[model samples]
Target: MGRNTRKRRTPPAAKAIAAAAALALGGGGLLWANFHASAHEPDQRAWGGNQTKAATAQVATVSCPDVGQRLTNVPDAARQGVARELAALDRQITEAYARLAATRDAQAKDPGFVRNAIVGPLGEKRAATIDRIRIVVQRAGGSFDNALEQLAPCATRSANQTNAGGGQQNGDGQQNGGQQNGGQQDNGGRQGGGIGGQAGNGPVAADFVDITKVAPNVQGKPRRTANASTGTFTTRCGVNANKNHNTDNVIVAPGVTNGAHHLHDYVGNQKVDAFANNQTLLQGGTSCRNGGDLSSYYWPVVRVQDGTRDFDQNADGGGKEGNVGRILTPVQAEIKYVGSPAAKVVAMPRFLRIITGDAKTTTNGLANANAHWSCTGFENKVQLTERYPICPQGSKVVRSFAFQSCWDGRNTDSANHRTHVAFADPASGVCPNGFKAIPQLTMRLVYAVPPPVIRNGQVMNAYAVDGFPEQLHKPATDHDDFISVTRNGLANQIANCLNRGQNCA
Candidate 1:
């Protein structure tokens, strides 16, 4: 699965190697941004002539040994070693940032600055650090398993932010504790910021940024199947009581109790869910965190109406009847995950199946006209945003919101969990805009790593996003969607840098 299996022109393995190289060599240019340096410039230190105020908040240092301790409990000694190595790598990243900041400060005061003097030493230091980390990972006995999981959350602080309760450094390069050497050396000998000797100058290296928490994205749609007969399934209420008498019968035979009614099309990718243990709430008691479902929670689907109007009691229920009372066009579902008792009960395993047709029933003043419409197409898809929760024994926890619509017409009424033709609507054609659906199912099982471990000084907790792509889904479907990645923005930026690496600072 890890072999090169891409297009004739470019192998997947090659592209992966190139990406890793770009990041490591600083060819990606992302690191330059952290130092407020331009990608086109020659040396990052050249810009450090103007020193900004040093951040004052001191970070509570999390050392490599601390992370190593966590790894000790894991049965796999090799995995533990990888964790320790990753922790050391994180430490190197932090030091690189510090070195860059120091180098830049030194050059700001001295007009005669050498670029190699600054960049060379930092690169060497970084290389040594990287080698040490690699050695540790190499010693780890088992295959690299969940190494990203342990490494993702180890946060590194930025040099720009104020240090916690420490002495100050300002934009003018003034050191509070020392004599100024034409703004060169403060008595402290700290090199930059009016401190003593000048350290080599270079742009501050970029630190790791946690990207776990983001604006909730649209998961997928759910609706009735195209083949299901409009009148075959019976509604919970009879036809006479329906506001749209003709349309109300969308739910028909077998009654709503154990009817053929099925929820349609909704789905949340379970591959991204992190693993967890439901038995305990203590930190490290379970692997699930964030929204991963260790506890019982309900995500309620609610209607958000923009305007109000009376029902079309008089219409015959066709073109005009369907337009009566302004029923929502079903843009998206709004789900509430926590603090809703009604929602929680409704989400239970059996109960969830019972109320599949819980849409509001309308009455038309006739016994046959009354019926409850199937809410299958109306509900929005919900996802456990955090790592997959550790469920208690016999606890009902949902890993994915498998909408009935996805399997409505297919033989997969049960959770076959097989990859199928996604995004094949004839109306929109194949491959939606800005997306290229790869027919091959590159299944990457992502582990959730929480923060302030991944990013330093973050006010909100974050999660580390790491996973490996799995095998392909063969004999691709006609409706296959273009596989899109929301987290590739950074990668794109890296690509931009590699294509123009020579001129980059």
Candidate 2:
């Protein structure tokens, strides 16, 4: 399974298409901006204005050190040891931040409580853990400063304090506060009316163009196609048995606690968080039906909130959406894997993370275009609503997710964890040239949402996922994240079986 043993092929046409698409979409420029933008940008705006504009202190470039690289030159035993210690440190860092966020949320109204009771203690603990991480990196012969720079800043010195002043405001007041604080407002701060916004009242026309429809029709037949001889292997990961409500697993968006604004259901790996590295993930147990495959899968917690309840009732600040009430668990989770017949699929590098859907979307209509909501039998009839769908008596509600399967052969992750990978052409189901095709992973989630109750002239649905809480839980907020932790044996099996076209379970 060494890197040099794998054969490399160049699909010049596909590479050209991918490059053209990247340029046309301005992906390179956007990637640069996202990388340079502050991880605490949203939180800073949430608090009010930038407090560092006049400060002379240089901001550190925060990133995740590639633990994979550090293991290369080391002996096998020593490599394992490094991974184990790093995993342990990752957990410690995440727990420290979680404790801080919980305390901050609980005592949000009291600046003194946050500063003394929350920030000070947690900041010290985080700093210590970070120091330990640096030592671990140095022991592995990597630069400590480089490792530190990959991390999100643990301290926030300029968070706004007035919202915690014991005053509860309506959604409009919250929106206005965001505007006055120099935060960008979409659609005059209407509930869910900005980027990633859900539809209001009724379904609106699709606002975003589907990329597959516009991508150039690269002429030429695919070298391989899935047929009777070519097989597919599927792994049934069990239902989301764990809820990850903290922001610790999102390494790229460090220092962002509850940044998702909603909870997520987790499956496969038992121990995963913002700080988890490949070693921790490999050592963890799984909730998957197969048990052996330890890949991580997660998505937003979908709830069916009634008119009386809301998810953001306990939320701080003003841009709150609707009532999200008690969170509901999904009935089941289905994860499957398949590969192309023309090429031997390559193993995914450790900690290869992928995300779909826009977490920042508001009511701008098209933000959640990737998010699809539908009733069980009528999966084709998708809708864009802020409210949960009221399926027919016998129907089930479901959320479907498809992930990108092509890799650039080098990096497990990028600044965005996206640019390094691209989706196969929808028409040809063939990955572009230069990228290796891996197992295509797809997830189907079913939630328990009861029929809607008619109140006044409005059709009110029960429970919903927590978003801004001012807007309805629209499909725009539907998103998922995955990190491959499949053991090397199984990964090779996928490659061997798929290339030979043998079906596997």
Clash counts for all predictions: 75, 40
What are the TM-scores, per candidate, against the unseen true structure? 0.24, 0.53
Residue 139, model 2, lDDT: 70
What's model 2's overall lDDT?
0.44
Which lDDT tens digits does candidate 1 get at residues 460-493? Answer: 1211110000000000000111111112132233
lDDT of 2 by residue, 37-119 (tens): 22343332221111111111111100112222222333322333444443443343333333432243334345345335433
Window of ten residues with lowest summed lDDT in model 2: 26-35
What's the C-alpha lDDT at position 250 in model 1?
Answer: 10
